[model samples]
Every structure is written in C-alpha cells, then in structure tokens.
Target: MAVLMEKKFPVEAGAYETAGEVSTTIKRTLKQLGVSAEVLRHVSVACYEVELNLVIHSDGGALTLQVEPDKVTLISQDVGPGIPDIGKAMTEGFSTANEEARTLGFGAGMGLPNMKRNATEFDIQSEVGVGTTITMSFALDMKG
Candidate 1:
C-alpha cells in the first residue's frame, strides 16, 4: 500500500501539441527505476492511451503514476461531459471523436480497449454530469 515513487502530470483538453510527453517521461522513469521490460511496456502503452483520451475526450484531466513494491498504478481523472454509455465506449470501432481528433489520426476507438489489454487490472467510474476516472494497475512480477 506504500508507494515507492509517484509522479503526476496535468493534461489539458485539446492540447494536441504535447499529447504523449507525460507517457514518455513515465517510460523513462520506469526504465531508470530498473523495472522489467514487459512491465514497462504495458505501463507505457496504457499511459499513453489514457493520456491521449484526456486530450481527445475529457475537458481536462490529471494523470498520476504510482510505483509500489508489487505494482504500478496509473490513474487518470478527467472533468466534464463524461461517457454516456460505458458499454458502447468499450466496444472496439465505436468512436465519437470530433473531426479534429479524427483528422489527427487519433480516435480509432482503441484507447480504452488497448488500456484494458495492456494493464493487468483496469477500472472506470463516471457520472453523466460529472467526470470519469480510470485506474489501471500493472503487476511488477513474472506471475502477472
């Protein structure tokens, strides 16, 4: 339950200029921490996917990465216009991305799916008028 290290990055909605910067920093930090390659890979993919979601979907959000002795946790909390249907959103090839986001080659409807695939554990919570919070955990062990 104790964190060994933690880093937080603020993501602005529609900030296409610096979408993946935080995820890049996270990968570097995990590598420097001597985390295994497999675990780092999972974390990197999920981190980027969630970060991009904040940029392309949320009004704005903050991403926090916490490293514990046994696991790595990536939490993304975003504000406003939350997802209406979690079931539909989870379906592949189902996207409601704006024209700008689609033009940028994003919003292929793979963000949530990819995050779920990469993380050992994934959970999401949201309300219609509120915000969305996604938490993904990667176990730092071979057994995972």
Candidate 2:
C-alpha cells in the first residue's frame, strides 16, 4: 500500500512530563487529513496506549504513524528490557509497572490489551535483552 503520510516521534522512558503529546499530535494530524472519526478514535486510543507503554516499560523508543489509502499504521519500537512473557503481558490486568508509574495512575495493565482491542490488526514481537515492537493498523472507512 502506498503511504499518504508518515511521522515519527521519539519517546523518552519515564518522561512523565511529556507523556501524551505524541499521541495527541498523531490524532490531530490524522484529523487534519480528514480521516474518518471512527478510525481516528481507534488510532487515538491505541496510539496513547502504545506511547505510554514506551514511556513506562521500554528504555526509549520511537512511535511512528503511517497513513495509507486503506489503513493507518502505528509502530512502536523500544530499546531494552523487553517483555519476557508475551502471554502474561497480553493479559488485561497483568502489569509490571513500577511504583512510580502506579502512583501516577498510568499503568493499569490495560495498555497492550486496549491497543489490541482498538486496532483492526495488531502484532507484537519481543526478544529478551533486545527490545519490543508493537504494530497496530486501523482500517480506514473509505465509503464516503
């Protein structure tokens, strides 16, 4: 599929000061491009979830947005301390978030599950000591 637009934002670990900015920018960009409200809503949720995951879990990473004719894709790639258990992590209430994250009310173990639930297609890959990458795609409603 040909990409109509693409943007990447770098996320710093534990950077609570600027946590949700990237996802907000993504949503706004998509909205400015005249994307359907349904698709924009899904992308917003999944984008926020994945961006928070990068901040709370991974060392550091980049979140990328790609807009295609048929779909919008969000890719998050992080550096280290990758997820050890994919199955457990996928559980709705399973969280490895530290006390700091908990105090901020950010990590409720719903990030991954919510991202998956909001996207039309979701895929995650991780390797111990390497990193984790999550890719989520939302199919655009092109029937205007």
TM-score of each candidate structure, all chains considered together? 0.95, 0.95
**Could you give candidate 2's per-residue lDDT for residues 22-133 as a string of tens digits?**
9999988999989988778889989998998998999999999999988999999999889899999999899999988899887889989999889988999999899999
List of clashing residue pairs for candidate 1:
none
Q: Which ten residues in a row have the lowest lDDT in candidate 1?
A: 135-144
lDDT of each: 0.92, 0.90
Residue 9 in model 1: shift from native, Å?
Answer: 0.9
**Count of steric clashes across candidates, in order:** 0, 0
Tell me the tens digit of each residue's lDDT in model 1 across 1-144: 899998889999999989999999999999999999988988999999899899999999899999999999999998867999999999999998898888889899998999999999999998877999999999999443
Quote the RMSD, in angstroms, for model 1.
Answer: 1.3
On a 0 to 100 scale, what is the lDDT of residue 45 in model 1? 90
RMSD of each: 1.3, 1.9
Runs off by more than 4 Å, candidate 2: 142-144
